[model samples]
Target: MKTNQFLFGLKNLDRGQTMKVAIFANDDMTSNIIFAQLFNMSDIQITGLYIAASPRKGTSSIIGGAISLLRRMAFGYWLFLVFTNGAFKVYEFLTLVFRCSPQTGTFYSLRRAAQLRGVRYRKVADFSSPEIAAELQNSNVDLLIIRVGDILQPKILDIPHYGTWCVHSSLLPSFKGIAGEFHALRTKRAPIGSTVFEVTPSLDEGTPLGQVAIQRDETGSVFQHMVNNNIAAGKLLASMVLQAFQCSAPSFELYTPQSQLKSSYHSWPKPDELKVLHRQRKALITPGEAMRLMLAAFRWG
Candidate 1:
């Protein structure tokens, strides 16, 4: 559905009826952007900020960490290597030379931003912890916004009165797992976008509240495309929350059910699969054609 139609027929929140909102995400640029956008919304009362483990430290074991690093290198650097014939090494060297670690800077900036806003900031080792649940309950949060992290437990999901919502980086039901944007790019699929949905026990299986197709930019890198998708997702999430608050129902019920037949799950690609994906992305339709296909697939409600 188009975002406008999805948000139609809902009133804005009544004055003094702010929705208490807590956000969960890692300290990254995407998270920072999401937080900043939500914080600016007048209807949302920012409650707590839960920072998950950094992607650099996502795994507990060395082997797992190595695997994670390889995945990152494959997704981030491999594409460049394919086109530049490994000359991207000089670009990487120059980046290191200039101390241009954008992710690191974004992490610290997020922390500082939270401090300035006086929001309760917690670095959580486990999202499903009883401690976190208790904290949310005590704070009386009306909504929980998950921008990033692992699947949450039912206890965590049930804390918020309005239930938890997540901004997933893929069109609902389809591409419902890790590296969704990469998977979409690899498949050369159109209507590649983001979904804002109610968080359920199942991963990305909740009813979608809003969705927006991302405009593809062929000139950009994979990382840039992912960031663009995330930003659009975050904005749609904020819009959903605002519209829900305007609803007259005691519990927010503004949602569109996803199709079971159309939905599919994805996982991290294997090394061979990654090579195939790289080849597919390199050989796929141009950005203009991709955008046209995406628009054609976008069915307005």
Candidate 2:
């Protein structure tokens, strides 16, 4: 949708209607950026947070999560993930020990971000727990914003009066599942995009509350593009939440259900797909970019 169309439906909130919001997310660099945007909001109260240990279900422990990954993909790719995650975890540890603020565009864990915001958070194995549902009800949560891999159960979904919404990294009715941005990159989608949608039982097939797309940078690496896309998604989510809180609904003009469109759902990128990216001369992550990111995550002081 165009920028004007997105803004056309926004209405200012009355003084007494502050939304009590909760967040469900994975504790990663991208989530940290997203959480920062929410924490900065002055109007709504963030009632609670659920930071999943892993995006996957049934395997929240280090050992169980690793085993789950191996079951889904090749061992080689799992090793690649281990190394990549290890590096980020080390940076998170450093930030904690040193007590430093993350530099702009740098990585930080969601836990650190929560601490900085002074918001209490809970680490959960998955989102299906009755206990979590009870907590949301007890907190009088008005809305639930989710950016996790676990599919929520109806009990959890029913806790929030306004229902759960998700921040997705691709234009809905196009790339609808995991790594949508990656799929867009490999498929050469001209302008990559992000969507904020109402989460239903169907994966990514909810009503799109807001969306924005950008022209892909031809010169950037795949990792760079993905990171930038996620950052955009984070900002987009914050804006949508504010709009929803103010008006009690996203502008009716913006409500397009995914079922009405030719939406495609994607799973994890296969090994051949990764090879195809390389064949197209696209580097997933340049070593220089990785090193620069690591250095920026640390406090020089």
User: Relative to the true structure, how large is the alpha-carbon lDDT of every model?
Assistant: 0.60, 0.70
Q: Which ten residues in a row have the lowest lDDT in candidate 1?
A: 292-301
Task: Tell me the deviation in Å of residue 209 in model 1.
Answer: 1.4
TM-score of the candidate numbered 1? 0.69
Q: Which stretches of candidate 1 lie over 4 Å from their true place?
A: 1-14, 54-108, 217-220, 248-261, 280-301
RMSD from true fold, candidate 1: 9.3
lDDT score, candidate 1: 0.60
Q: How many collisions per candidate?
A: 0, 0
User: Compared with the true structure, what per-residue lDDT tens digits does model 1 show for residues 153-214?
Assistant: 88888788767778777777678776676667666544467877778888677777667777
**Top lDDT hit:** 2
